[model samples]
Target: MKYSPLLSELISALTCLPGVGNKSAQRMAFSLLERNRDGALKLSAVLHNAMEHIRHCERCRTFTEEPVCEICRHPQRNESGLLCIVESPQDVLAIEQTSSYQGMYFVLMGHLSPIDGVGPADIGLDELEARLKKEPVEEVILATNPTVEGEATAHYISQLCDSMNISATRIAHGVPVGGELEYIDGNTLTHAFSGRRKL
Candidate 1:
Protein backbone atom coordinates (compact mmCIF):
# COMPACT_ATOMS: atom_id res chain seq x y z
CA MET A 1 0.00 0.00 0.00
CA LYS A 2 2.93 2.31 0.78
CA TYR A 3 6.28 2.84 -0.90
CA SER A 4 9.55 2.07 0.90
CA PRO A 5 11.19 4.92 2.79
CA LEU A 6 13.89 5.35 0.12
CA LEU A 7 11.32 5.45 -2.69
CA SER A 8 9.13 7.88 -0.79
CA GLU A 9 12.10 10.10 -0.14
CA LEU A 10 12.95 10.11 -3.82
CA ILE A 11 9.41 11.10 -4.71
CA SER A 12 9.47 13.84 -2.09
CA ALA A 13 12.77 15.14 -3.43
CA LEU A 14 11.44 15.21 -6.98
CA THR A 15 8.53 17.35 -5.78
CA CYS A 16 10.99 20.08 -4.85
CA LEU A 17 11.22 21.02 -8.55
CA PRO A 18 9.03 23.92 -9.72
CA GLY A 19 5.45 22.97 -10.77
CA VAL A 20 6.05 19.39 -9.61
CA GLY A 21 3.27 18.48 -7.23
CA ASN A 22 2.86 15.23 -5.28
CA LYS A 23 0.94 13.67 -8.16
CA SER A 24 3.55 14.66 -10.71
CA ALA A 25 6.32 13.46 -8.46
CA GLN A 26 4.55 10.14 -7.99
CA ARG A 27 4.11 9.83 -11.75
CA MET A 28 7.74 10.68 -12.39
CA ALA A 29 8.99 8.26 -9.76
CA PHE A 30 6.88 5.45 -11.15
CA SER A 31 7.92 6.29 -14.72
CA LEU A 32 11.58 6.41 -13.79
CA LEU A 33 11.34 3.08 -12.00
CA GLU A 34 9.32 1.30 -14.65
CA ARG A 35 10.42 2.68 -18.02
CA ASN A 36 14.08 3.68 -17.88
CA ARG A 37 16.17 2.78 -14.88
CA ASP A 38 19.43 3.39 -16.73
CA GLY A 39 18.25 6.81 -17.94
CA ALA A 40 17.16 7.69 -14.43
CA LEU A 41 20.55 6.65 -13.03
CA LYS A 42 22.31 8.70 -15.68
CA LEU A 43 20.14 11.71 -14.87
CA SER A 44 20.95 11.44 -11.16
CA ALA A 45 24.65 11.07 -11.89
CA VAL A 46 24.66 14.09 -14.22
CA LEU A 47 22.79 16.20 -11.68
CA HIS A 48 25.31 15.32 -8.98
CA ASN A 49 28.27 15.96 -11.29
CA ALA A 50 26.93 19.29 -12.49
CA MET A 51 26.15 20.40 -8.94
CA GLU A 52 29.69 19.55 -7.87
CA HIS A 53 31.61 20.83 -10.89
CA ILE A 54 29.64 23.78 -12.29
CA ARG A 55 30.42 27.28 -11.04
CA HIS A 56 29.63 30.87 -11.96
CA CYS A 57 31.78 32.37 -14.67
CA GLU A 58 34.12 35.02 -13.24
CA ARG A 59 33.20 37.60 -15.87
CA CYS A 60 29.59 36.89 -16.83
CA ARG A 61 28.27 34.90 -13.84
CA THR A 62 26.94 32.13 -16.07
CA PHE A 63 27.34 28.56 -14.78
CA THR A 64 30.17 26.61 -16.28
CA GLU A 65 32.65 23.86 -15.48
CA GLU A 66 35.55 26.14 -16.35
CA PRO A 67 36.55 29.30 -14.48
CA VAL A 68 34.91 31.28 -17.29
CA CYS A 69 31.98 30.13 -19.40
CA GLU A 70 32.33 29.29 -23.10
CA ILE A 71 30.83 32.63 -24.13
CA CYS A 72 33.38 34.57 -22.10
CA ARG A 73 36.18 32.36 -23.38
CA HIS A 74 35.24 32.53 -27.05
CA PRO A 75 37.73 34.67 -28.93
CA GLN A 76 35.34 35.29 -31.85
CA ARG A 77 32.60 36.77 -29.67
CA ASN A 78 32.59 40.54 -29.89
CA GLU A 79 34.78 41.45 -26.96
CA SER A 80 34.92 44.72 -28.88
CA GLY A 81 33.52 47.04 -26.23
CA LEU A 82 29.95 45.79 -25.89
CA LEU A 83 28.24 44.36 -22.78
CA CYS A 84 24.65 43.10 -22.41
CA ILE A 85 23.28 42.90 -18.88
CA VAL A 86 20.65 40.25 -18.10
CA GLU A 87 18.80 38.89 -15.09
CA SER A 88 19.99 35.29 -15.28
CA PRO A 89 21.89 32.62 -17.20
CA GLN A 90 18.62 31.53 -18.85
CA ASP A 91 18.25 35.03 -20.28
CA VAL A 92 21.73 34.63 -21.69
CA LEU A 93 20.59 31.44 -23.41
CA ALA A 94 17.45 33.10 -24.73
CA ILE A 95 19.44 35.96 -26.25
CA GLU A 96 22.06 33.60 -27.60
CA GLN A 97 19.39 31.58 -29.37
CA THR A 98 18.62 34.67 -31.48
CA SER A 99 22.18 34.46 -32.90
CA SER A 100 22.03 38.24 -33.44
CA TYR A 101 24.01 39.48 -30.49
CA GLN A 102 27.74 39.04 -30.84
CA GLY A 103 28.63 41.04 -27.75
CA MET A 104 29.65 39.84 -24.27
CA TYR A 105 27.13 39.45 -21.43
CA PHE A 106 26.83 40.22 -17.72
CA VAL A 107 24.36 38.22 -15.66
CA LEU A 108 22.83 40.00 -12.69
CA MET A 109 21.85 36.62 -11.12
CA GLY A 110 18.70 38.37 -9.80
CA HIS A 111 16.83 41.68 -9.86
CA LEU A 112 16.65 44.31 -7.12
CA SER A 113 13.58 43.75 -4.95
CA PRO A 114 13.55 45.81 -1.77
CA ILE A 115 10.39 44.19 -0.44
CA ASP A 116 11.98 40.76 -0.76
CA GLY A 117 15.23 42.07 0.76
CA VAL A 118 17.14 41.62 -2.51
CA GLY A 119 19.46 44.59 -3.05
CA PRO A 120 21.94 45.68 -5.71
CA ALA A 121 24.86 44.23 -3.77
CA ASP A 122 22.94 40.98 -3.32
CA ILE A 123 22.91 40.57 -7.10
CA GLY A 124 26.57 41.51 -7.81
CA LEU A 125 26.17 45.25 -8.52
CA ASP A 126 29.60 45.97 -7.05
CA GLU A 127 31.20 43.44 -9.35
CA LEU A 128 29.39 45.00 -12.31
CA GLU A 129 30.69 48.44 -11.39
CA ALA A 130 34.22 47.11 -11.01
CA ARG A 131 33.99 45.30 -14.34
CA LEU A 132 32.76 48.43 -16.13
CA LYS A 133 35.75 50.30 -14.75
CA LYS A 134 38.24 47.59 -15.72
CA GLU A 135 36.78 46.45 -19.05
CA PRO A 136 36.66 48.57 -22.20
CA VAL A 137 32.95 48.42 -22.92
CA GLU A 138 31.71 51.02 -25.39
CA GLU A 139 28.06 50.22 -24.81
CA VAL A 140 26.22 48.60 -21.90
CA ILE A 141 22.83 47.17 -22.95
CA LEU A 142 20.22 46.58 -20.29
CA ALA A 143 18.47 43.35 -21.32
CA THR A 144 16.53 42.75 -18.16
CA ASN A 145 12.87 41.65 -18.43
CA PRO A 146 10.12 44.22 -18.90
CA THR A 147 8.72 43.68 -15.40
CA VAL A 148 8.58 46.26 -12.62
CA GLU A 149 11.59 44.89 -10.79
CA GLY A 150 13.49 44.49 -14.06
CA GLU A 151 12.82 48.12 -15.02
CA ALA A 152 13.87 49.31 -11.60
CA THR A 153 17.07 47.28 -11.81
CA ALA A 154 17.81 48.65 -15.27
CA HIS A 155 17.12 52.21 -14.11
CA TYR A 156 19.50 51.79 -11.19
CA ILE A 157 22.23 50.41 -13.44
CA SER A 158 21.63 53.11 -16.05
CA GLN A 159 22.00 55.81 -13.42
CA LEU A 160 25.18 54.23 -12.17
CA CYS A 161 26.54 54.05 -15.72
CA ASP A 162 25.65 57.73 -16.23
CA SER A 163 27.46 58.72 -13.08
CA MET A 164 30.49 56.69 -14.20
CA ASN A 165 30.39 58.10 -17.77
CA ILE A 166 29.61 54.71 -19.30
CA SER A 167 27.34 54.53 -22.38
CA ALA A 168 24.26 52.63 -21.18
CA THR A 169 21.20 51.60 -23.26
CA ARG A 170 17.94 49.70 -22.83
CA ILE A 171 16.55 47.14 -25.24
CA ALA A 172 13.62 48.32 -27.40
CA HIS A 173 9.92 47.43 -27.50
CA GLY A 174 9.83 43.85 -28.80
CA VAL A 175 9.70 42.47 -25.28
CA PRO A 176 6.14 42.78 -23.92
CA VAL A 177 5.45 44.91 -20.88
CA GLY A 178 5.80 42.81 -17.70
CA GLY A 179 7.16 39.93 -19.82
CA GLU A 180 10.19 37.87 -18.96
CA LEU A 181 13.20 37.61 -21.27
CA GLU A 182 13.25 33.83 -20.84
CA TYR A 183 9.78 33.51 -22.43
CA ILE A 184 10.34 35.86 -25.38
CA ASP A 185 10.95 34.42 -28.83
CA GLY A 186 14.39 34.48 -30.44
CA ASN A 187 13.32 36.89 -33.18
CA THR A 188 11.83 39.30 -30.67
CA LEU A 189 14.94 39.17 -28.54
CA THR A 190 17.10 39.77 -31.59
CA HIS A 191 14.98 42.72 -32.60
CA ALA A 192 15.08 44.14 -29.12
CA PHE A 193 18.86 43.85 -28.99
CA SER A 194 19.30 45.31 -32.47
CA GLY A 195 16.93 48.19 -31.73
CA ARG A 196 18.23 49.08 -28.29
CA ARG A 197 17.78 52.74 -27.29
CA LYS A 198 19.99 54.97 -25.20
CA LEU A 199 18.87 55.20 -21.58
Candidate 2:
Protein backbone atom coordinates (compact mmCIF):
# COMPACT_ATOMS: atom_id res chain seq x y z
CA MET A 1 0.00 0.00 0.00
CA LYS A 2 3.07 2.20 -0.08
CA TYR A 3 4.49 3.91 -3.17
CA SER A 4 8.20 4.57 -3.62
CA PRO A 5 9.41 8.04 -2.65
CA LEU A 6 9.63 9.20 -6.28
CA LEU A 7 6.17 7.85 -7.06
CA SER A 8 4.73 9.59 -4.03
CA GLU A 9 6.43 12.80 -5.06
CA LEU A 10 5.04 12.50 -8.59
CA ILE A 11 1.53 11.99 -7.20
CA SER A 12 1.90 15.01 -4.94
CA ALA A 13 3.16 17.21 -7.77
CA LEU A 14 0.34 16.09 -10.07
CA THR A 15 -2.14 17.03 -7.36
CA CYS A 16 -1.08 20.66 -7.81
CA LEU A 17 -3.07 20.78 -11.08
CA PRO A 18 -6.57 22.17 -10.78
CA GLY A 19 -9.25 19.50 -10.13
CA VAL A 20 -6.56 16.81 -9.76
CA GLY A 21 -6.92 15.39 -6.27
CA ASN A 22 -4.90 12.70 -4.54
CA LYS A 23 -6.81 9.79 -6.12
CA SER A 24 -6.64 11.29 -9.62
CA ALA A 25 -2.96 12.11 -9.20
CA GLN A 26 -2.29 8.57 -8.03
CA ARG A 27 -4.11 7.17 -11.05
CA MET A 28 -2.12 9.39 -13.43
CA ALA A 29 1.22 8.60 -11.78
CA PHE A 30 0.52 4.87 -11.79
CA SER A 31 -0.61 4.96 -15.42
CA LEU A 32 2.52 6.81 -16.48
CA LEU A 33 4.87 4.57 -14.51
CA GLU A 34 3.18 1.27 -15.38
CA ARG A 35 2.36 1.74 -19.05
CA ASN A 36 4.00 4.84 -20.53
CA ARG A 37 7.33 5.83 -19.11
CA ASP A 38 8.46 7.22 -22.49
CA GLY A 39 5.31 9.36 -22.74
CA ALA A 40 5.84 10.53 -19.16
CA LEU A 41 9.43 11.56 -19.97
CA LYS A 42 8.22 13.50 -23.04
CA LEU A 43 5.52 15.20 -20.99
CA SER A 44 8.06 16.18 -18.32
CA ALA A 45 10.44 17.62 -20.90
CA VAL A 46 7.71 19.62 -22.66
CA LEU A 47 6.28 20.96 -19.40
CA HIS A 48 9.72 21.99 -18.20
CA ASN A 49 10.47 23.75 -21.50
CA ALA A 50 7.14 25.57 -21.44
CA MET A 51 7.66 26.72 -17.86
CA GLU A 52 11.13 27.95 -18.67
CA HIS A 53 10.32 29.78 -21.92
CA ILE A 54 6.69 30.88 -21.82
CA ARG A 55 6.01 34.28 -20.35
CA HIS A 56 3.43 37.06 -20.48
CA CYS A 57 3.27 39.04 -23.70
CA GLU A 58 4.50 42.58 -23.17
CA ARG A 59 1.42 44.15 -24.79
CA CYS A 60 -1.51 41.99 -23.65
CA ARG A 61 -0.02 39.78 -20.93
CA THR A 62 -1.10 36.55 -22.59
CA PHE A 63 1.31 33.61 -22.51
CA THR A 64 3.94 33.44 -25.24
CA GLU A 65 7.52 32.33 -25.77
CA GLU A 66 8.42 35.38 -27.84
CA PRO A 67 8.25 38.97 -26.59
CA VAL A 68 4.70 39.35 -27.85
CA CYS A 69 1.89 36.90 -28.52
CA GLU A 70 0.81 36.12 -32.09
CA ILE A 71 -2.51 37.90 -31.63
CA CYS A 72 -0.83 41.00 -30.28
CA ARG A 73 1.71 40.98 -33.09
CA HIS A 74 -0.98 40.90 -35.76
CA PRO A 75 -1.01 44.36 -37.33
CA GLN A 76 -4.74 44.19 -38.12
CA ARG A 77 -5.52 43.79 -34.44
CA ASN A 78 -4.17 47.27 -33.81
CA GLU A 79 -6.01 48.63 -36.82
CA SER A 80 -9.29 47.35 -35.40
CA GLY A 81 -8.86 49.73 -32.47
CA LEU A 82 -11.06 47.57 -30.26
CA LEU A 83 -9.49 46.12 -27.14
CA CYS A 84 -11.34 43.28 -25.43
CA ILE A 85 -10.49 43.01 -21.74
CA VAL A 86 -10.55 39.57 -20.18
CA GLU A 87 -9.60 38.09 -16.81
CA SER A 88 -7.34 35.30 -18.03
CA PRO A 89 -5.43 33.84 -21.00
CA GLN A 90 -8.08 31.08 -21.25
CA ASP A 91 -10.65 33.75 -22.03
CA VAL A 92 -8.51 34.91 -24.94
CA LEU A 93 -8.41 31.38 -26.32
CA ALA A 94 -12.18 31.03 -25.92
CA ILE A 95 -12.81 34.27 -27.77
CA GLU A 96 -10.40 33.32 -30.53
CA GLN A 97 -12.16 30.00 -30.97
CA THR A 98 -15.33 31.89 -31.89
CA SER A 99 -13.50 33.61 -34.78
CA SER A 100 -15.97 36.48 -34.41
CA TYR A 101 -13.58 38.94 -32.83
CA GLN A 102 -10.60 40.39 -34.67
CA GLY A 103 -9.46 43.03 -32.21
CA MET A 104 -6.74 42.91 -29.59
CA TYR A 105 -7.03 41.70 -25.97
CA PHE A 106 -5.83 42.76 -22.56
CA VAL A 107 -5.63 39.87 -20.15
CA LEU A 108 -6.00 40.89 -16.50
CA MET A 109 -4.66 37.52 -15.29
CA GLY A 110 -7.32 37.80 -12.54
CA HIS A 111 -10.26 39.83 -11.34
CA LEU A 112 -10.28 42.36 -8.50
CA SER A 113 -10.94 40.55 -5.22
CA PRO A 114 -10.39 43.01 -2.40
CA ILE A 115 -11.50 40.52 0.25
CA ASP A 116 -8.72 38.22 -0.84
CA GLY A 117 -6.36 41.21 -1.00
CA VAL A 118 -6.24 41.20 -4.83
CA GLY A 119 -6.31 44.72 -6.26
CA PRO A 120 -6.18 46.47 -9.64
CA ALA A 121 -2.40 46.69 -9.59
CA ASP A 122 -2.18 42.99 -8.81
CA ILE A 123 -4.28 42.20 -11.93
CA GLY A 124 -2.27 44.41 -14.32
CA LEU A 125 -4.72 47.35 -14.38
CA ASP A 126 -1.83 49.82 -14.34
CA GLU A 127 -0.41 48.28 -17.50
CA LEU A 128 -3.86 48.35 -19.12
CA GLU A 129 -4.33 52.01 -18.26
CA ALA A 130 -0.97 52.87 -19.75
CA ARG A 131 -1.86 50.97 -22.92
CA LEU A 132 -5.11 52.88 -23.19
CA LYS A 133 -3.29 56.17 -22.82
CA LYS A 134 -0.66 55.37 -25.42
CA GLU A 135 -2.61 53.27 -27.91
CA PRO A 136 -5.26 54.46 -30.38
CA VAL A 137 -8.06 52.43 -28.93
CA GLU A 138 -11.54 53.41 -30.16
CA GLU A 139 -13.47 51.26 -27.71
CA VAL A 140 -12.80 48.87 -24.85
CA ILE A 141 -14.92 45.71 -24.62
CA LEU A 142 -15.17 44.36 -21.07
CA ALA A 143 -15.47 40.61 -21.49
CA THR A 144 -14.95 39.70 -17.87
CA ASN A 145 -16.96 36.84 -16.38
CA PRO A 146 -20.40 37.26 -14.76
CA THR A 147 -19.16 36.77 -11.20
CA VAL A 148 -19.41 39.53 -8.57
CA GLU A 149 -15.65 40.06 -8.71
CA GLY A 150 -15.76 40.22 -12.51
CA GLU A 151 -18.54 42.80 -12.41
CA ALA A 152 -16.59 44.90 -9.94
CA THR A 153 -13.49 44.72 -12.12
CA ALA A 154 -15.50 45.71 -15.21
CA HIS A 155 -17.06 48.68 -13.40
CA TYR A 156 -13.66 49.87 -12.22
CA ILE A 157 -12.23 49.67 -15.75
CA SER A 158 -15.32 51.35 -17.21
CA GLN A 159 -14.89 54.28 -14.84
CA LEU A 160 -11.25 54.52 -15.84
CA CYS A 161 -12.27 54.53 -19.50
CA ASP A 162 -14.83 57.27 -18.86
CA SER A 163 -12.15 59.47 -17.27
CA MET A 164 -10.03 59.12 -20.40
CA ASN A 165 -13.06 59.82 -22.67
CA ILE A 166 -12.85 56.33 -24.15
CA SER A 167 -15.83 54.18 -25.03
CA ALA A 168 -16.32 51.19 -22.71
CA THR A 169 -18.84 48.39 -23.15
CA ARG A 170 -19.55 45.35 -20.98
CA ILE A 171 -20.37 42.03 -22.59
CA ALA A 172 -23.97 41.06 -21.87
CA HIS A 173 -24.67 38.23 -19.48
CA GLY A 174 -28.06 36.51 -19.50
CA VAL A 175 -29.88 33.23 -19.91
CA PRO A 176 -28.31 31.08 -22.58
CA VAL A 177 -29.94 30.74 -25.97
CA GLY A 178 -32.38 27.78 -26.06
CA GLY A 179 -32.51 27.87 -22.22
CA GLU A 180 -36.09 27.83 -20.96
CA LEU A 181 -37.08 30.85 -18.89
CA GLU A 182 -38.67 28.60 -16.27
CA TYR A 183 -35.35 26.93 -15.55
CA ILE A 184 -33.32 30.14 -15.49
CA ASP A 185 -32.28 31.94 -12.30
CA GLY A 186 -34.00 35.22 -11.40
CA ASN A 187 -30.81 37.24 -11.95
CA THR A 188 -30.28 35.71 -15.40
CA LEU A 189 -33.93 36.23 -16.28
CA THR A 190 -33.68 39.86 -15.27
CA HIS A 191 -30.55 40.33 -17.35
CA ALA A 192 -32.19 38.67 -20.36
CA PHE A 193 -35.23 40.90 -20.00
CA SER A 194 -33.19 44.07 -19.65
CA GLY A 195 -30.76 43.15 -22.41
CA ARG A 196 -33.45 42.20 -24.90
CA ARG A 197 -32.83 43.41 -28.45
CA LYS A 198 -35.19 44.54 -31.17
CA LEU A 199 -36.48 41.85 -33.50
lDDT of 1: 0.91
With a 3 Å backbone cut-off (N, CA, C), the pairs that clash in candidate 2 are none
What would the C-alpha RMSD of candidate 2 be, to one decimal place?
Answer: 1.4
TM-score of each: 0.85, 0.95
Please report the candidate that would top lDDT against the real structure.
Answer: 2
Top candidate when judged by TM-score against the true structure: 2
Looking at model 2, residue 91 earns an lDDT score of 97
Give the alpha-carbon lDDT of every model: 0.91, 0.95
Q: Model 1 Cα displacement at 154 (Å)? A: 0.5
After superposition, which runs of candidate 1 have C-alpha atoms over 4 Å from their true positions?
Answer: 174-199
Cα distance off (Å), candidate 1, residue 157: 0.3
In candidate 2, position 90 carries an lDDT of 94
Give the per-residue lDDT digits (tens) of candidate 2, residues 4-87: 888889999999899999999999998998999999999999999999999999999988999998999899988999999999
